[model samples]
Target: MTQESSRTPPVQDQAAPVSGEGAQAFTRAQVEELFLNAAREGDADLLTRFLAAGMDPNLRAEKGYTPLILATYNGHAQAAAVLLAHGAQPDLQDEKGATALAGVAFKGDVALARQLLDAGASVDVPNAVGRTPLMFAVMFGREPMARLLLEAGASPTLRDGEGLSAVDLAQRQGNTALAQDIRHAAQG
Candidate 1:
């Protein structure tokens, strides 16, 4: 396979290459953990290699964090891009039901969030707590992230499980200016 090939068979569809004839077989869980670790460490090359080797790009860790989620949480844009190119599902939620977009929002990473959006990630998918990416941004005082999410069509009127909108969360967090800005954007 060429170095640029992004799509590959799922891990179960292919046999992992062994270094030698007598080498012990690696379980699927071990491979998944390796993939997740590579994502968390920002090792784009390792991710590429894994994908090339037919390891599933969408594998989740013990906490249900996909490679894309781990990469975004660690600010590894390159790794994220690699995962996306390899068909990683950006909307898959972790244990907390937080998508990769939410991770970027918490990190205040507009660029990473943009990458996810461009790859068809939903801007309005909420976590287990019903907190959308916009709410996460607002709660964390991530103005740029909130702005980007708004521009990408995040619903400002959507409320969390607690029935608090992003603007309300912003206000509760003492971000008056950002709350006003979000309110205006929501209204406009």
Candidate 2:
């Protein structure tokens, strides 16, 4: 009996090569803990192993932090990349309703924000306080990130739950330059 000749499948379609009996010994909770730690430590290799083992890239840890949330918030670009590539949900909010983009915004990470945007993160995802990424950037004086978000279609006039817009936050934060920039962008 002849079998089908094409045994080689796409690498990602298969469970990645895991070695040793120890690989099978972890309990689900242990695996969960490892994913969270890997995200926090920026361990891309360990992250890949878990992802290839069919772990949910969006699995939430304590305080409802997903691997993507933890990785990006910690400024782990490579780990965040891996998570996004493995199908992490860019819009998943934590228990506090903060999206990964919202967290990255306050950090002044323009490149990381671009990455998140490229990965389909919404530019205007509001948190529990109804603050969008643009508001966070403006309030934190991340002028460049705020500009990037505006160029990406974040509404400068968007009001948070506290009835403050990005411009309002920028002014309140004492960043007149950013407020001017935001106003100009809005008018244009």
Candidate 3:
């Protein structure tokens, strides 16, 4: 896409608005680009407007990244809140089979993870490799996130495609103590 072509079409004219040109109407590509940019930038107000105007909250990008995924992955709590309130599916997976909850756990955004959990996202939701949010958190040394997931009922004993549970992954990442902590937490 050219730089000049990347700009959104004018929302309106000062007086007489052109036909088929306004806030509610847009080409499919323009709508996709607009939503992707808005979500990525955490533009809550813009997202509210787009959603109010009947934009699909779950529209996915070429990589199967929905607006909710982008907003949460980019750490936009308000933007993500708006999308979720507008009916964005919290469990919608990207092309890599990563859900919003799993992404937030990997990114270590506990607040975002809580929001997703409240939105009914599965705590044990897995990626393509069957690595749950707990596994991602433990593997990346996100103790706070791992704790939250464990509290949310994420299965520490669940294994990934490589047969690594949260504890196993922590150990592989050289966090033997973290692995033990995960084990202890799961037990108690």
- After superposition, which runs of candidate 1 have C-alpha atoms over 4 Å from their true positions? 1-25
Clashing residue pairs in candidate 2 are none
Per-residue CA lDDT of model 3 for 56-89, tens digit only, reads 9999897899999999999999999999999999
lDDT of 1 by residue, 28-107 (tens): 66667677888999999888988888878878677788888989999999999999999999899999899999989998
Q: In candidate 2, where is summed lDDT lowest over 10 consecutive residues?
A: 1-10
What would the TM-score be for candidate 2 when compared with the true structure?
0.86
TM-scores for all candidates: the values are: 0.85, 0.86, 0.85
Candidate lDDT (C-alpha), each = 0.86, 0.85, 0.84
Off by over 4 Å in 3: 1-25
- In candidate 1, how many clashes are counted? 0
Error of 2 at 113 (Å): 0.5
For 1-188, candidate 2 gives per-residue lDDT tens digits of 11221111112222343335332234456657777898988999878877886789999898989999899999999999999999999999999899999989999899889999999999998998899999999888888999999999999988999999999998999999889999998898
Q: Could you give me the TM-score of model 3 versus the true structure? A: 0.85
> Which of the two candidates, 1 or 3, achieves a greater lDDT against the reference?
1
**Could you give the C-alpha RMSD of every candidate to the true structure, in order shown?**
4.7, 7.6, 5.8
